[model samples]
Target: MGIEFTALHWIYVVFIVLIIGFMVKRRDTTLICIVGIFMLAIGATGDFTSSISGVFNSFIYAITELLSTILIISIIVAMSRVMMTSGINEVMVAPFTKIIKTPALAYWTIGLLMMLISWFFWPSPAVALLGAVLLPVAIRAGLPALGVAMAMNLFGHGIALSSDFVIQGAPKLTADAAGIPVGDVVSASIPLVITMGVVTTIVAYIFLRRDMKRGTFLLNTVSEENEDSTQAMEENLLSIGQKRFFAVLIPIAFILDVMAMAVFKLQGGDATALIGGTSVFILLLLSIVAHKSEGLEKTTSYLIQGFQFGFKVFGPVIPIAAFFYLGDVGFIQIIGDHLPATSHGIVNDLGVGLAAVVPLTKEIAVVTLTVVGAITGLDGSGFSGISLAGSVGSLFGNAIGGGTATLTALGQITAIWIGGGTLIPWALIPAAAICNVSPFELARRNLIPVVIGLVVTTIVAMFLI
Candidate 1:
């Protein structure tokens, strides 16, 4: 039977076209998402009352599915903030500073720290903390602000966030769409994630070295006056004893958490729970250490600040994710009431329809999926587009033969690595803002290396998966 386009499907297509137009014009994604949702609701119900209700229901559903992960991320961010405000962030990176006296070492050190911290606390909080403390040191050690930003983007957002071994956000979405265990996605992603990280980091290092040789490297450092200002900021944020305690306690706690997670078979939600529970414990500890008598009030204050930071990091991406979520049959059925009960894979159906009209080979399919991933990543949130990729992956993979999950994972990685901010100007804003570099410049510097790494990773996945 020929696939017929319903009003709801047409509305989705139009919404996608508008969103793409908005992205090309460098307009706001959040605004586009809201408009897209409105269009989808109206198209599906064809009645104002039901359309309005559908919009509200979709919004609520989106938030409900995401709330647990968001809350966990927020709490971890709060812990990082407490660590930073308590001066633990400085102490955490101090050891690396001594070892990373050169630009090369500084780049790797910063990347490693970002990966480690992101694995535990997630990239959002990790970037904030790393930028606040480690960026200065790396820059002073002769690493360019652009280079530091690139490393953080690749390692934290691209690698750690993609694997999501600790929090499992990315894996959860992919697994749900594929009807596989989250643990399967997590396990399957690790080798791919590691390959991408190593290739990307090495390529980035080579580019940085080439730039250094050409004397195009920019030194990052504060003036003596600015150093004094920074010190003052530190003093106001942390007392001597509080600084000392956290300086000792926070790292030890994180190391223990890692060991425990590894020692135990904690996976999926359990892994995130472990990290969140630890973050709360650490938050309480820092509060007690920092505020003493007013610890309760102070801890609550820090948590509020952390939530604000988390929302700032994640809030803008949620609506975009909601729109993408509709692309999944599971979610499409919820949103598109008239969809057939037998229509198990809506994304596959759409891809198949397109495939029939447009000539597509295996290589073309792979490239198309990669490009789609990169496009989805334009909103600068990596996990947001994963469900779409997973859905598309299954469709194309089955058509091509076997290895649907593998291709889906590859597509997911590419989308996240590129649009997740490693090589896109607008997407890199958060990391650029934290590193005090021009986001455009960082994106430009990152493009070649990241692309090379992505190519290598895709090829590797084709064989491995």
Candidate 2:
């Protein structure tokens, strides 16, 4: 039952470590990944020309696999831009300012509201919408910009995205890789996700409050710059009626979309498509309403801007993701069809090998899966690692008796929470940019709370499983 590590496998392991090392130093790993891909290709083909071709093909394959996610994000950003320009985004949060009267209320209110919005429209768009709207309110209500950033990051990216109960994209990714039903993963993840979310956000809020009391919570230079830009953007000329109409219209449209999703039982890609398509339509509608005579040009302009933002965010991620994809189920497609017939995926093989080598009791299985999930998340794309987590979960489950669903859910939660946005500076950019704080600062603030949350969630998962 012993598994031998092939040159490809060994190379994969080495590159993963190098990538983690680079990430730890807060360095860019895109170039390192491309080089790793070349070396991996060479190991597989032993032909310089073929290796070069394989590298290109691997990038192409990664893009193909990730196109849906990229497209949805782009479309949502486009929709948000349209809302912002129309002055609707401002109106969207006007109602909330009434309830968020103090810093404590502002923190929890913004965090909970962000969590809800992120569940439906996704965190990318939610950040854009809320940053333009709620962030200013939070700041005006005596919350520091960094505190605002932490709340938004933890709730939107950390909690909503990690659970992904509404879109079910994360669970689907894990389930598909494990060859299990998505419902099983989703059902099992709910408790763990809630535990992580509640604990992390509460702990982070307390830290924020402590900082405020100590007078260490003054706004940084970045916040002043962001505030000035925000004020400039807010100086828009719009009829009151137009703003009111859109503020109401946008929420109604999203509410209907959610209802439709429930009625249709749409999950995963279908659900994303529903939301993305609705966003496009809303963008078009708002553009036309805002610029009746020049709507055509305006719509195109908004779309062009959205695509630019989307591609800009995704550019560095593609290369890193391509390198990791090769170690998972996508290897045969990325490399060549002629990979050894006996070859299991690099990660899958490693998981099985570990299960064989280690004495895995229930506690050990939980700890191992949690560690593996966290390690896989180092890529800063919470998603790319889930397949590995799922595969490893299955292997471990088979080695033991059962609880594959619980283990898979635990791994999924840990991977998404760590890499989805909380701990990774690169991944925290969306929330950081919106809150106008340094991504590194936000990551640092989130580190303790998230780590504690993950540990508690994993421990709870042990009993649940």
Candidate 3:
């Protein structure tokens, strides 16, 4: 059951370490990522021409996989542009101004709200739908832009995405691989999810509060250079009544989409498509209504702005994403089938290898599952190598004679929390771009809280097991 390590795997691990190091130092990792992709390709193909092509192919593959997410972000930004330009955003957030009167209130409210919405639409779409409406309110209420990003990232991606109770997608994956009923995994995860969510959000809020008190966070979030575009109040094209109408209409439209998702069992890409399409329509409708004579050109102008912002946010992310793609199924497609016949992707192999080497003591079981889960999660999907967690959990379960569900659930939580979006830079672009913060900065902000939560949760799992 021991995994045979190849040059491809080693090269990937080395690059990952380098990338993490660079990110920690706040250095750019684009060149390192590109070099790593080339090294992985060379390791895989051993042919000069194909290896060179593989690097380019890896980028293409990464972009294609991310295209849907990018489109949704672009469309949402385009929609927000019209709302802002027409003065609709001010009206949209006006009601919340009274409720979230303080930074603490803003952080917790947005966190809880995002956690709730992410359950249905997933974090990417949830971010698109909510960030536009809530972010301005949060920032205006005294919380910085980075705090808003942390709240959304931790609550939406860390809490709701890890648990996935509504969709039950995460549980289903781990359950199948663990040879247990999905219900078992869900039931077992409830307490741990609650623990991690409450603990992490609280810790993150505390850190944010301290930073604000120490004047670490910039109170005026808008940069001086871009103040004219982002901060200045634009002349309202629509009348006050018109702004009020669209403000109400927009939320209602998104609400209906949520209902449609529940009615039709829409999730993931299908759900995202519905939201993206709705955003496009709203963007078009509002542009025509606001600009009247200049509507057509204005609509395209807003779209151009959205695309510009989206690509600028994503530009630094592509290289790192391209490099990690090799650790997953992207390896075969980008570089051809150079993996060992028994290999189940490099990331999963590493998890299996870890599980194979670790002795199956109950105490060690929880620890191994966490480590293995984290290892698998390095690829950033949180879903790609989770089956290995379940499979490994089952293997260790036989030794302990109980706690299979707990172990499996622990693996799922850790994997999703780390890889889902909370920690990974590229994986978290949705929230980062939406809140207009650096994904690496967001990841850094979440690291302490998430790691603490994970450690505490792991210890709690020891008791549960």
Identify the leading candidate in terms of TM-score.
1
On TM-score, the stronger of 1 and 2 is 1
TM-score of 1: 0.86
Give each model a TM-score: 0.86, 0.84, 0.65
Arrange candidates, best TM-score first: 1, 2, 3
Candidate 3, RMSD to the unseen true structure: 7.2
Say which candidate scores most in lDDT. 2
Give the distance in Å from residue 430's predicted Cα in candidate 2 to where it truly belongs: 5.4
Cα lDDT of model 1 by residue, 1-465, tens digit: 356656656666677667656654546667766777777666666677776666667667667766767778889877777676666777667777788788888888888889988887788778877776666777778887777888888888778877777777777776665556777666666777888889888988887888888988667433354344335334555666667667777778767777887889777777777778878998998777666788899899888987886677657656766666676643554456556554544555665566676665667666767776777676566666665667667667655655666767776788778767687777788788876778888888778877887788777776654
Tens digits of per-residue lDDT for model 2 on 159-259? 99888876666776677556577888888888888898889998888888898999987744245666565554433445778888878887888789889
Better of 1 and 2 by lDDT: 2
Clash counts per candidate, in order, are 1, 0, 0
The 0-to-1 C-alpha lDDT of every candidate, in the order given, reads 0.72, 0.78, 0.77
Candidate 3 residue 279 Cα shift, in angstroms, is: 0.8
TM-score of 3: 0.65
Question: Model 3: clashing residue pairs?
Answer: none
